[model samples]
Target: MDFRAINTIVFAFLITMCSFGQINCNCSIGSYLEKIELLNTRDSLEVFELSAELKKTKLEVCKFKALEIEFNYFITQLNEEKAFAVLNELEDYLGRINCESDLKFNIYINKAKYFKLHNNYEKLSEFAFKALKEAEYLKDSNKEIEAIKQIVYLFTRMDEDDKNWQYIKRAEKLIFKQSNPIRSVKNFRWLAFEYETKYTRTKRKPLLDSLFIFANHSKKGAKKYNIFDELALSYRALEAYSYHKGNAKNALKYIDSAIFYAKKIKGKKNLSGLYISKAWDHLDWGEKELAVKWMDTSFAYDTKDDIAGFMMHHLDATDLYEQAGRLDKALSSYQIHSRIKDSIFNTERTQVINELETKYKTELKDAKIKRLNVLLVITLLIIVSILLAGSVIQLKRTRKKNKILKRAIEEQERLEKELSDVRGEIAQDFHDDLGNKLARISLLSSLISGEVSIKSPNIKSKIKQINEDANGLYKGTRDFIFSLKSNSDYLEEVVTYLSDFGGDIFNKTEIKFTVEKHISTNVKLPYYWSKQIVFIFKEALTNAMKHSNCHTVKLSFGYQGYQLSIRCEDDGIGILESDLQSLNGLSHMKTRGIKIGCELLINSNIGEGTAVILKGNLKEDII
Candidate 1:
């Protein structure tokens, strides 16, 4: 069959397996592939339906296997572009899908096959090594054997015999640990091809014997596994070996066997190679016409888009044509072969240039992106710096304003303290100097009154009254000094001073003065409030001592909640209610309490004593 018909069959078989394999019968992948291989190839419409149905399956493993099969189908069809596109899809899915080691092994093996078809030996070697590692990780001896075989094939193609033999031995070690007939057949065939090539180059008999032995070993496994492709390859290796030995009869026999088996498979990819071997046989046998015919047939079968294969076909044609004395055809074939060689060389050069251009463009784009990132960072930093600077400047201005206000408050406090000190000093001087002078004047008047009482009775009486006035003046001046000298900010100080003043005033009198204090020491009284309280107490005391004829006087200071109270009462001859207006001292006390925000009350009866009560809200006074 032709290449197109073979590819269509392979493509159809893959699609059928991918779509109906597990869906219709719940069959395993191996069973599905076997079933499809037995059926006739389907058409393109069936292939499309299969692809659509495969996409509908929810299983990631199924989708992944379908993609792999599609990739292989394209490879068999000699569709490198579509195969590479499928490979890209596989790689992209690999990152997204979490697959098992067996799946990874298959993915790498497929990639290796892709590079092998494209003749990219380096990449082929790379993926082969990767697949080998995945196989080892999976502990699948069969996959490992296949990967090692691919490595062997690549090394042999590159003419590195040492590397090729090293991998062959590695595959051999793995093959003994496993039982995969197909893989064993593949390994043996590779070994046979290796020995046959070596024998042809060195013309060694020992190498020829080794080649025949490996070829026969491969044939044994191929027949057991029904692997016709490897079997055909083994026959080709034997044909080359026999041809090198100058055994034309044996070589022709082997070539016919290679062709017979190769014809069983479609596309005739191996058949083309076998035809070349037959043409070589005809040349050796000196049948120039038959040689040309075989060469033409080989060229017709070389349908794959491989520049190296076409070049080899033309080169062989040129030699055959020259030997046949077809000078025109010989020169034409040589020229075509040379042109194809140049095209291959130029194609490689263009690829290199494209890679360099792509690399340069990528680097330039990266540099621009880096530069833009730096600019963005710098802009952000500059904006942040400006904001910080503005904050610092505003903070400094606020601190400066606070400093100015603090200094103003301190200076005001200093001046008020100085004024208070000056007032206290003046009060002290008034009490010490003026109060003492008035006391001395009163003593002198009393002495004069006593000395002239009998000789000048009128003069003694007037002098006695003057002495009483001077005494009253001294007491008033002392009271004034006491009130003025101390601040009333401390409730304890004010109450204590008032109690002391009452004690001193009635010390020589018959009236007993009792000071009852129940106020907390922490209570604060305003200055004006304290002075008015002291004045009211003094007035009540003086009125009692001079006119009430009381035996005891009680003075009390108390506080509850935020209210302060001062009380003074005496058990004396109580004044009449009509006489209250006549008392100027009582009136003055009332006026002072009003000015200091205190409530003043006077209670008196004809037989009971008089009581003066003062109540003040200390909190109201402070406010």
Candidate 2:
């Protein structure tokens, strides 16, 4: 109702809303703490499950940042006694993770602490030096200082007293003049540790006094919960120093203190190495049975495949068994050692030989195939050489025969030319002189027959017979001249003429004749040889048309290289083998083929038609 009352109510509502916001903030904080506890307890799977839930609840950034913080908290919980085991797990975890810069720095520092706690001086120096490099990259002055301190401590543990002092002196030079008292104090503390634990080993009282003074100054800044592991390591260093100084009682006393803090923050994996160290200490005290018992416990906890650790345990077991006169047990342990040594050597030898054996076998097979291929090539070359030699011998004989045949052909050509000239002269004389006289006689006989009438019919018949005989003699002279002219043309012309003549004969016999073009004008043969080949083809076609009673006849002629071939095939009642051997036509064909240096092949059977193939080389005289 009132304006003042409304304003007061608004103010109260604002305060109440602010209060609820604070409560929600506190609840979120509480949940983050619980997740940190889970990580510290090595419950990574549970933390991962919670992270998934957080992502679904719109807290992805919060959950992811929490994971980073939890990783640091887990590192803090890992005690100095279990430092090596924790470092191993941390290394494994780092290998599995893709961590950011801040988280990575924290992991590195924890790793340095673990190596330091185990008194692994070399590894401690290495990791601490690496951590310094990472810190330089990060440009974090605080991490750099921490890394330098760890490195100095590692060198001290390694008995590199001068190097340790050098690093601490450098830190002192850098930080002693700074305005930041806390940083100055921390530097002073490391310098004191370097001089007291490292340099004081040689009984240098002046350096010890300097160490005591600086350590007193460092007390304020050194009060931090995370430094507990470092403190325990410092005590172990003191114990080692006492042991080296020949004060066993004092060394044991410091070792107890070292163990106290080491147990307080022990890690899961590092307990085995710490126990082994403790076993060694007991052995030094002549507590053999207790040392053995601690060693067995250490062995049980050793989950890593650390060769040095296994060897140490093996040697200890062997000594104990041998001293107890258990020869069989000692022998068994020795056999194991021998077996491991042999297996390593054999593995290396096997690896070296494996590649060689593979190459050897491959090359061996290739060589065998190459040998076989060479043998096959030699055999083929021998066969080819024999064939070439036989061909060469036959060709030489053929050349000799061809020379003789060429001489004969030249002589025959001359004789034939002379005979052709004489025949032409004889045909002209018969046509102009004898032919006109016969024609006059025939005209006179006709006139005489007409005048004689019925009284002399016998004389008239005799005169008419004389006129018919004179006409027959003139036709024979004309045919002889044409035959002589036909012999002068090339073989191709002769083939054409014979094919045309054969077609005419087939037409008369009512048999189909198919002529295929065979010889070309380029083919040359002697006049006599050409005449003989044409006559042979003509004769074969005549026999097929007249005697074979063939319905279809195929005539083919072709020239291959120097050889001219003619083939005649007819569908007819074929000749038997007996008849082929005795047939005069076949004998005449063979004789004609021999005279022309041609090969005549006759293929005939009882049902299949006869095929005559004539093949011959063109005479060189014609070309």
Candidate 3:
């Protein structure tokens, strides 16, 4: 075997040993923190395994810490949905514990980081400002500076140069006021990086100058404290400043110096990140060969056992190698990267599904929901595969490309919410627009009946019919709107509405209208069922008033076993049995009844009365 293969096996074995050591760690908050910290040390994919163990822990505090670590993991991985999940749990746990201000401050900071990652500036601002206040209350300069840095980071990401510089300068002044300024070494380097980022964005000369000052200040702190990481990062900033200033020789000098310090610590692990970043910069600069060299160097240092770090560098290195026309190496790197990517994607998918299933099962107790969870997982998998696509062949992580696999689920939720809102809006608009016009038509007919005098008797009779027709339409529209808005599941509500309509149609006439309910239990009716049932009964009542010549009409609601029954009966000079089916109103009621899975029956005699009864299986409709 080649040396690299031997090295890989050794690294894997050592990590397995460390992980096994950590796995049986005593159940405590400290153990949870240490295990989660392995995310930084061992591998990013270790987060999934460690989080699984943390979930099974009985300690809420450990769970809270695990979620915090997972939040950072997801944020770095650009998995916004999982990040959102961790943030939600962490927030919930925070409230349950009623943690002190220091802990609350950290949680707020975590929240701010999450919103920043998701590009939710509105929420980022809220939490970032909250952290600032907490820092002030705690009177911790480091915390205060950290909060300010976060706010500055937000504005920087948003490309708000004015706001970014304002916060950066404010943090700068505060850090300088401190006695040692050594505690703020990393803070200075962060400010330097921000300046470097701003300079890149705007290409402003002043930003370039400010970055040099901060880099120098960071270097001073690093030299004073012998903080090798900060020392190397300071030189990296200086290198960037020099390179941007068109001093390539000086830039190379600073980079070599940075590497010198970088190699002095951490087995060049940090150097791998620096190399990959610069490799990307060089690749963007069109120096493909140099980019390839640096990418390979970074990959060499990246631990093969650190699955996420390996995949990250390999993915980027694939792009670099591809651009350099090293097709064989690119293909090899891409294969490994794709395999790891697919593994992580599948793991995250199962985790999200499990979380959703647990949440839904807790909130909704139904076998149907369990069935729906299966569909959810299948749908999620399909969407992730579709969106992911052959871009895995390229394997570069762009912001647009890194929108997170759970985007499909979030987008589905958003669309569902939008659809419900539109339904409500359309229903309201339908009611308002048609209801007003119908009411106007009825008012006009009433005015024409009382105020206008028609000389011909036939014309006057026609006018009375028009007025009654207009009133019937106006009342029908009102009932339809009521049914549309009602959320009641019981059939009794619809029966009451029909009875009220019967009273309205028979008003001022010599007809008595009675409504009776013999329901032993609530028979559930769907939303569409309510509108259909009401309209069917309305047609029966209108027919009884206009044609049945009924002196008394009764509407009854009843339920038996699993069946629903409704009757509209009238005592009038009834129709012939042959004419019962031939009645004009009977057809419309039957059509509406068919929609609700009901059979409409018409019973009439020449001298007795007519009864329109409806029967249907309530169980089927409910299902």
Candidate 4:
């Protein structure tokens, strides 16, 4: 027998032995698959026999895998008839015998590839979606990524850019979830090609950059896996990027590199495609003779079945010939182009026939599956009814609990308001009654001190001490009343109070106080949050007033989107970073921010100044 036959027989023998031997059957199966993949189109008979031998295996999964390998072999050889026949066989196998979801998934992907290769867009779209659904059901991210990529390409070919972008977005999401290096490389290369095509059409700088990025990533992955084909494609992408950037020298440099790599690989198709690309660049730059030279060189490289590339070359030749005033040659080239276009039309018609046959078969299979699905649906409905009854009872309990929770929340809010009112009343009592009384005491003591100074020095000293104590008590009461006041929670009210308080406190001092409000005056906050925020602000201000020996203390407020931001900055000899660890007031400000669900930032330098920022999400906290 021939070498291929001998090789196939040996591999099959090894697999059979391993199946009954002590070695792992899966390892032997993989070896068998490796051998099959190693065979080219010339080894068709051997491939066919080896593929048929898969049915001898006891494992159903292996049978499914064998069918996939057989189908792939036919596809790679461009034997569409055999490929579809094998696909139909696989479908029949699935109908009669039980197979794993993975097997079924592979069958769907194979059918998708068949349709895609034949340019049956409608069938390809349907199969791609089916594959995606299966992949998602199996939680197979790699498979899902492949399906999404195919769908993206299909939509792009259909000129449905919006739909293509949606699939691109989906592929991006799925790619990150897959951790396989080779698969990642493949996905990135697909993305690179997609963007590269778009760049070629639009000549958009951003799209070119995107292509370069993904292409670079693909190169890295390919180098890691020793995949020369992908490496060559990456180089071609770089060439495209450079050419589009108006750098002919650099573009030619990359194309040379790509050609060198492509020569090392088995596929002359890629090599010829590169030559076509180089020719087109020369043609675009008005180098007609150089373009013709490269076109002849491309023809020398056996570009098997590269119809698109052939079309491009023919069209370019026609243009050049017409420009040279060679009417006969130009007419001949145009006629050849017309013939190629007719062939494409014929191919499209064949694909339509294939699509109809596949659809009819699918419908017949679905009719059978639908019967089984109806029984499953009935069983599911019974389970769902039981679940629904339970859900209703549980939902009622949840509703009851929600009602109780709401009532408790309302009651709590009411009590909080009442408590705030009571605190306000007490503050009013302290400010109006106790503060006035203390002031009166201070005045009376001063008068007594003046009257007794002539009679007794001891009485005069005692009256003077009483006056100083009353003055201290009055000041303390005023500060306490200010803290207890509820109006501080309102945005406008707090800002006005801060301005007046700062003006009064710093009036006699050299320091200046500034309050700048960037937010609306009508912006209101929850009572608890506003209270905490104000308390934090007061602490920061107090620290600045007591310690920062500066000219200005500025307070600013801003609201953007859902966030409310407040800043307290002082122009002063700021606190040391090391000293900040021990600052009690700063710690209190941070704690209050945490309690209010805000982010607090404190920035300080020894000589620059200090800034305190408190930011919170108003959308979440306001309610």
Name the candidate that leads on lDDT: 1
TM-score of each: 0.44, 0.28, 0.35, 0.46
Give every collision pair in model 2: 79-265, 79-266, 85-269, 85-270, 518-557
Q: lDDT tens digits, residues 374-461, model 4? A: 6575455546555878999999999999999999999999998998899899988888899989999999998777777476988888
Q: How good is model 1 by TM-score?
A: 0.44
Best by TM-score: 4
* lDDT value, residue 169 of candidate 4: 70
What global local distance difference test value does model 3 have?
A: 0.72
RMSD of 2: 39.1
Instruction: Write down the lDDT that model 4 would get.
Output: 0.72
Report the C-alpha lDDT of model 3 over 167-280, residue by residue, as the tens digit. Answer: 787787888777645556777788888888778777889988988998999899788767777899999999888878877667767877888887765321545867876665
Best of the two (1, 3) by TM-score = 1
Clashes in each model (backbone N, CA, C under 3 Å)? 0, 5, 0, 0
Worst 10 residues of 1 by lDDT: 35-44
